[model samples]
Target: MNNDIDSALARFAGAEPHAGLAGLEDRVMCAIASRSSSSGLAMGASLSAAAFALVLGIVSNAVPLAEARAVSTLAPFGAPSPLAPSSLLLEPR
Candidate 1:
């Protein structure tokens, strides 16, 4: 095993240096820049979506407990949902 290792080392020492590929550095740099730009856009979109969700949650939760109870009491059977115009129309006496 020692002899094999020595022979391998000797072969490597005698080998010529490898010529790197042309424009490899430029291509790698361009790929990195494109990935970075795309990641930045993705990060911005993710943050925007998170903020929108948070604001929506806050706004939805800001309703008073009494108001929530009142709304629930008004539609206990889930009929005539809140958005139905018929629910808001008052019957004439």
Candidate 2:
């Protein structure tokens, strides 16, 4: 039994390691280079999208401010009472 185990161990120990995919190093380097180049494009697109959103947000909010104040002015204005039911509701009751 011990000899059988020893022979099996010897066979395993002498077995060659697997030969991996050919040109693996070149494939990995190419993938890294391609990713690095594409990253610049991705970054530029992200920045442009952010800038456009900022501009749109500013325009949308800015355009509404004056109109909101005008609409509010046309209604009677005074400080709302703490106990007012209308104030508690999202819209005027």
| TM-score, cand. 2 vs. native | 0.35
lDDT of 1 by residue, 7-87 (tens): 999999998867777678999999999898879789989999999999989987886455433534446465667646675
How high is the lDDT of residue 26 in model 1? Answer: 97
| Residues 1-93 of candidate 2: C-alpha lDDT, one tens digit per residue | 579889999999998866786688999999999899879889999999999999999999878755434323323457665556676776656
As for candidate 2, its clashing pairs are none
lDDT of 2 at 15: 86
Q: Stretches of candidate 2 above 4 Å error?
A: 1-33, 65-93
Q: State the weakest 10-residue window (summed lDDT) of model 1.
A: 67-76
Note the Cα lDDT for every prediction shown: 0.79, 0.79
Please tell me which predicted candidate would have the highest TM-score against the true structure.
Answer: 2
Collision count for each candidate, in order: 0, 0
